[model samples]
Target: MIRIVLIGLWICAVALGTLFFTVKSHMPASGDAGEKASYLGGIDYATTDVFSVPIMTDGSVAGYIIAQLIYTVDIKMKARITVPLEYFVKDEIFRQFYGSYSDTKQVEKVDFERVRKSAIDGINRHFPEPVVRDLLVEQFTFMPSSEIREMNMKSIGKRLSEH
Candidate 1:
């Protein structure tokens, strides 16, 4: 009876030890998840925003900019945005910023300085409570109208040749 009880307890101990080791090995290490890994290692997100700025033809501003004619021109653009994992963690501010930026019609270009200032101001204003270590802009491309047409033509030619 003593031998059996000792063997049973020994088995239980071994089992518990194995289970603990397995769980600990499988669990993520501290700061080893998601954007933390990328940010810490200096690996930037692969994302971009592409847009066009219509140049002023003649002296008159484009109809889209009649009232809003500031130092900057209106640009039609397509953005390839990567939502950082950190941003997703911010429920309220993230939702507001996401909603505001989702509209293609609302996209416009201001002076680069103005844009920079506004972005800095926004970060200062909203991110005070939360600890965000880094926000990175991975890429920005300006797609001209001519380049679009040329790319379309090349794509079409390639398709025709393939067929």
Candidate 2:
């Protein structure tokens, strides 16, 4: 009876060890997990803060364009950029919108494809290599100056009434 009990305990230990080893072998290594963390292994996204630009028409302020953008760059290439990408993005957006005013004055018909291509090209031109992969519009909107003034007035009125 004592020998049988000892043999049964040994068999249980062996089975547990085999199960542990099997699970361990099937599990991903630490290095593999790290690689998976960066699913886009080579590409990374850089997002810009919300910014606004005044659209000029006939040498005066027409309205304002508010925008926020996200751009993609190769993770390796991003390290090579010395200046913040926001500068390029904002400049491109301004140039595109402001420049269009001279041609048509109406931004409603703006071609998004052209803007995307232009932004990518414009940013790439400043770099030694084309580091900017693509541009994505997170927010692109136009608010007339009158609408802004009206909104501000309403806000002020509400605040005064609360007091």
Candidate 3:
């Protein structure tokens, strides 16, 4: 039993060492590549800053969704642009978001997955060829209207000053 345990431990150590050696500096920042790929498989990936998506009600802004997005594709993805492809993707992101008319229509509830799919579809339509394999919403925040922020700030400020 002791000898078997020792051999098992040795095998684990060797496996771990090999994994670290192979992945070091090669693993991209995020996501699961599984046995098929690394993060984007070391392919070109684009990310966006937090998008303040306005939620409209009664023809006015009701709330906002702070969304950060990621676009991942295979290493073969290419583009013809003077600016970094990320920036170009960023511009297209907003265009696709607003083009859905979500800001104009009163969206009482937000389905993030639905929004993500719509955005992807819109972007693909804008592009003659599909460029992104997947659209990942890394961060999604639902912020209340500006009126709420001011009221909250004032309440906090009043309490802070009292103390």
Candidate 4:
């Protein structure tokens, strides 16, 4: 019985090897459809313009956080990936940022990936398919209300001084 099993295994291996070589020889070349093929399946990614989201605390914009995100989706869904989606993405990132650290003052110091999964899920809601391969926080700045006011005041002052 052992000898018979060994012979059968050897024959199966040889057959598979022969089939592989035959198929390989007849297959199309690598570059034949390179242009038409997508590196990441058939999905293309869209990037959102830099946008800021309000970090709410007690029904107010406790802090402002800005982020640029990237997503992979079908081209047909480009329109859906617009302002609404941008707002959602920003909200998601803010939720993660705020939940992890209540105070936005430590936004830069807080670790983002801790809430990465949730943030990614929040962003992926726009796409029916889970095409969000990853979420990248290209730019993240967490500024407290005071700083924003100060910046605004400075800009106003600069304009007034110039005039």
- The local distance difference test score of each candidate is 0.41, 0.83, 0.65, 0.68
Residue pairs in clash, model 1: none
Off-target runs (Cα >4 Å) in candidate 4 are: 1-28, 31-41, 57-60, 74-88, 94-101, 125-128
RMSD of 1: 13.5
Q: Which candidate number has the best lDDT? A: 2
In terms of lDDT, the poorest run of 10 residues in model 4 is 75-84
Per-model RMSD to reference: 13.5, 7.2, 9.4, 15.4
- The per-residue C-alpha lDDT of model 2 at residue 45 equals 88
lDDT by residue for model 4 (1-163), tens: 9999999999999999999999999765678756555543456666778877677776667877766777555554554555545566667665665545555556657666665677777767766766465666667676677898999999999999998
* Highest TM-score against the true fold, candidate: 2
Higher-scoring candidate on lDDT, 2 or 4:
2
**Backbone clashes in each candidate structure, one number apiece?**
0, 0, 0, 0
Error of 3 at 2 (Å): 52
The estimated TM-scores of all candidates read 0.33, 0.72, 0.54, 0.57
Those runs of model 1 whose alpha carbons end farther than 4 Å from true positions after fitting are 1-117, 123-134
lDDT at position 77, candidate 1? 9
TM-score of 3: 0.54
In candidate 2, stretches whose alpha carbon ends up further than 4 angstroms from where it belongs are 1-39, 102-105
Model 4 TM-score (2 dp): 0.57
Better of 1 and 2 by TM-score: 2
